[model samples]
Target: MNKIVDLTLNYTNDFTGFSKETSRTIKKDGWNASILTFYSHCGTHMDAPIHFNVSQQTIDKIPVSDFVGKAWVIDVREVGSKGLITVNHIPNDVLNDFVSGDSLVFWTGWSQYVNIPKYRDELPRISKDLANWCVDNKVKMIGVEPPSVADVNNIEEVTKIHQILLKSVVIIEGLTNLEKLQSNCVELIALPLKIEGGDGSPARVIAIEKQ
Candidate 1:
């Protein structure tokens, strides 16, 4: 049997406490509820094309078939802080194994900094060349354990990377717990919330190891 690993982050309020709460008392019983305050990009999330382009497809309009598929996890842990993950970081043998429609998951070892400001502001990023490679190679989706594929502080680089990949590929961000998965190839499933017209939505990402 294959082992399943969850790669989603836990959602919480305001990075601290609940944003809103309500309670109702009926007879001798009571009910309580709370509204969550989270960024759509928070936790493990899917980036719809509309996230970068207004005229592009919204989250709900995204094809459900794109959410699950064979995936490759490339490890670039040796890359330094704020380093660029270029084509070279991907092993030649790994590139040879890529199929036109396979999803690519990058393990930059950045998930270790989640909840820290540095995780968003100072982290390794995918370079333009790598983005172009994915486009030219016909990658179905790109998943990363970091919050984004580009430097969070560099808007221009971020925009360019998003524009390039978002044009034809789904982007999965904020993945967690990928270090637990030992295989380089696995079945990936990133299911986003069915929010109509949403630019992007949080998702529950998982990997199924092959026996």
Candidate 2:
């Protein structure tokens, strides 16, 4: 049996960068469909290097294989509001086993405040040191529960971290329900819309719990 946990923030008409219009309904059109308007980088999304001008590669240009991988979660629940996350936060055992191509996830408890301003304005963030560490370690992808891996309000911090990490690895953000994952490691699948020339796109991210 495989246990799959959704690691994406639920979206709704009220959420930021998302709007839904009833285009068709069972009662009106004998079917059900809606027009969804979404911002490419909103909600649970994957960032392409081009998002930060790190490269010309768009989300669609990223290899599909890069979206699937064995991902290890580093529990950073104690990383309080606006806390700084460094490589030291990762457990030694996990770090010892971590290798090139293995994705990394920071399981911060920030998702609980998704509906509030703090979720974006005062979220915990990954430090520049950690970003560089990921690059040096050749991490394939890095996931974070916050809407962003760095302080979104700080353009310098956000741009620097995104550039440092995106240049070397793909990024998954705005994740939720990571606490539901029962294992330290899981098979991660995060598929983004294949928009041509897209800087980034919202992704449906899930984790197949280790069995």
Candidate 3:
């Protein structure tokens, strides 16, 4: 039997305090509810090229083919808090398993800290070399459990990483529940909301294990 793991964070009005509620009624009748909120990149999300570069592709402009592919989950949990994942963290055997156009998921165990201050302010990041390697190897997409690949406080590094990866590979960030999959390889399907001209959009990411 195969397994499916949802790699998305739960969005709530008070979770991150980033959501807004219009109404909640349960007195004598049923309920018609709505929410007013603003989140460009909150949950499991995909960053389009426009996120870091002007005149670049927007969320809706990205090819749907970029959202689905064979994924290789590289475990780097051994590198402790605030660690940086570099080319060296990736094993040669694992690199050998990747072919051009494969999706790469970094399992940094950081997803455990979603919605926390430290997770947003001090998450692990991918090194420039690793970012370059993803491009050179023709990776279709790169997924990380952290809020951003680079430190959220460091705009320069963050912009550079986004620019590098967004130019070629789709950048999937703020992913959760990857640790539940318990598999090295899986088919990843990440579909972002079709927000017109948006820099990024929340996504529903899933991992499908093969028999």
Candidate 2 least-lDDT 10 residues: 8-17
lDDT of 2 at 57: 93
Candidate 1 to truth, TM: 0.91
Clash numbers, per candidate: 0, 0, 0
lDDT of each: 0.85, 0.91, 0.85
Residue range 1-211, candidate 1, lDDT tens digits? 9999999887765343224444444544565555566567777788888888935699999889999899988988888589888888777888888889998998888888877888888888888999999989988989988888898688898999999999788999988887899999999999999999888888988999988
User: Candidate 3 — which residues are off by over 4 angstroms?
Assistant: 20-30
Off by over 4 Å in 2: none
Q: Is candidate 2 or candidate 3 better by TM-score?
A: 2
lDDT for 26 in candidate 2 is: 98
| Candidate 1 global CA lDDT score | 0.85
lDDT of 2 by residue, 19-68 (tens): 99999999989999989999987889999999999999998899999999
TM-score of each: 0.91, 0.97, 0.93
Model 1, which residues run further than 4 Å from truth? 14-32
